[model samples]
Target: MAGRAIVVTSGKGGVGKTTTTANVGTGLALAGRKVVLVDADIGLRNLDVVMGLENRIVYDLVEVIEGHCELRKALIRHKQLDNLYLLPTAQTREKDAVTPEQMRDLVAELREEFDYVLIDSPAGIEHGFRNAIAGATEALIVTTPEVTAVRDADRVIGMLEAYDVKDPGLIINRIRPDMVRRGDMLDIDDVIDILRIDLVGIVPDDQDIIVATNRGEPIVLDQRTRAGQAYQNIARRIEGEEVPFRELAESSFVNRLRRLVGIGNKRRKAN
Candidate 1:
């Protein structure tokens, strides 16, 4: 059977879209799924660097799409996981270098060999974004608990609906339990209420994310961090497992409300 293609995107920058992609991709790989990660943000590829395979990239997405190199030559295997691979985008090339049809074709080809293909989309609704989701069978929208980020995520959700991507899920990243308790930041309830999408994951604000990124290691490798656990849950959820959302250390009013409405706790119990 052909594998799945997922595009991880956010309409706004600095919302941890790429980080979410890397972690979730790695999480899925660690779960024993053969995976391939595509850096579709041409001219600004960071997925390779984040995955710690930047130096090994001799050929890239453009090269494969443009027929300069075969797909196998373009794929750089991940250091730790033999089944995980990276198809980095060309930093010197523009987004227009590869067409959407080409991207779709490449993704279709990848499906023949891998169990999952995750595409890291650029932050925008422009040509790069189009290229990123061209072949995506599923979508993951990443956003921080902020008004601007939520607004942008709403816009991206609308676009995904227009594109007819299947069952797009939301990832709420950089959440601060303290800020949520103090009413200083947008809570998970507020974001879900606004976006009105199925929740896939909630990543806590953890400094280990920075340390992991700097070391070119995915946060999901940490095992002890809540952020890592959150991603692993997300990967399982994506695999059609009924994984419950993790309750924050101190359940906020929002968490209580979610349970009271049978939106979170009751559903989790039913599942």
Candidate 2:
């Protein structure tokens, strides 16, 4: 049976696309699915670093597509999960290094082996973006609650529709409940109203995501932070599981104090 090839992208930069890819891929692997994360952002590869597989990368997507190395040789297995792997892109190669046809063919080959293939796209509608979505059977668009991010996400959704990638799900990242309560930022309903796509996940503005990235680990493995829980739910949703979205309430003074004092810090890591 063939596996699913899903492209995770955002029209604008700095919208946590790569982070979403790493966490969701890890979460799926934790669910006992054999997964491969393909870094399609040639010349600006990041999935490896985000997953802490940077040092282990000897071959990349360009090399595999170009026949310089075998596909299995290019896939670096995850440190903790035996089923999770990463196919990093070559940082020295340009976006034009791999054509859409080659990408589609590569992903077809990947589908034969893994249960899921998650492609991390670069932030743009250029050659890299086209190549990234060429092989995708489904798509996930990541965006923030900001107007600019939502606008760009709308543009990307249009482009995806043009390419016949229908019904791409939306992932709202870095949402601040406090800001939404104060009317300082766009709320989830507002963003959803604009994009008009099925909401897949909503990640809160948690500092633990930054800490996890700094430590070369994905936030989904922790589950202590709200953002981590959100990513895990997104993974389950991807598997066609009916996981309900959580209500993100504004943090109270006592909750903030509890977090600060580490009084309620014991959170069971998601398996």
Candidate 3:
């Protein structure tokens, strides 16, 4: 069966789109699914770097599209996971070098072999983003719990709707419970209220993510980090499993207690 394609995108830079793609791909591959992650950043590609496969890239997406190399040759297998692969973007080529049609065709061919195709989109609503989402069956919008990030996320959602893409899920990244408790930052609820999309995961701000990214290792491999667990949960949710969203530490204890005691359950039942 052909696999589903998901574009991991964000309207603003520094919102963790590439990180989300790497982690989600790793998490799914860890679950034993054959997965391919495509870096759609074109000239500013970093997905290969994030995956620690930059030094091994002889051909890239542009080379495949331009018939300079076979698609299989451009694909670099993961060093750790046999089933995980990466189709890196060309750092020397511009985004316009490959058209949306080429991207669609490439993804179509990849779907025949992999169980999942995850595209890491470049930041912005431009040609790179368009190409990234061209053949996607779904989209995962990554954003932080801040007004600016949420605003950009809302814009991205509107753009997706304008493009006729349905069911784009949201992942709130880099949330700090302490800041939210101090009313110094927007919480997940505020972000969801503004974005109005299905919540996939809430990843807390963690220092380990930085260290892992620096080492070309995705934090999902740690399994002990909160951000790692959150990414893993997002992967499971993408696989159509019903995983509950994690609660913020700032939420009222009374409310949390009530939730644990099934008070909210009764309210929903009554409704």
TM-scores, all candidates, are: 0.91, 0.94, 0.90
- Compose the digit string of candidate 3's lDDT tens values, residues 1-271: 8998999988999999999999999989987899999999999989988888888998989999999999999999988888999999988889899888889999999999999999999999889889988988889999998777788888888888887778899999998888988999898888888878999998888887999889998878766566777888999998899988764543445554754665532210000
Quick one: ranking by TM-score, best first?
Answer: 2, 1, 3
lDDT of 2 by residue, 13-79 (tens): 9999999999999999988999999999999988899999889999999999999999999999998
Candidate 3 is scored at a TM of 0.90
For model 3, what is the C-alpha lDDT against the true structure?
Answer: 0.86
Candidate 2 structure, TM-score to reference: 0.94
Give the alpha-carbon lDDT of every model: 0.87, 0.91, 0.86
Model 2 scores a C-alpha lDDT of: 0.91
Look at candidate 1 and tell me the lDDT of residue 185: 90
TM-score of 1: 0.91
Q: Residue 138's C-alpha lDDT in candidate 1?
A: 93
Tell me each candidate's RMSD, in Å, in order. 7.2, 2.2, 7.9
Range of the 10 consecutive residues with the lowest summed lDDT in candidate 2: 262-271
lDDT of 1: 0.87
**What is the RMSD of candidate 2?**
2.2
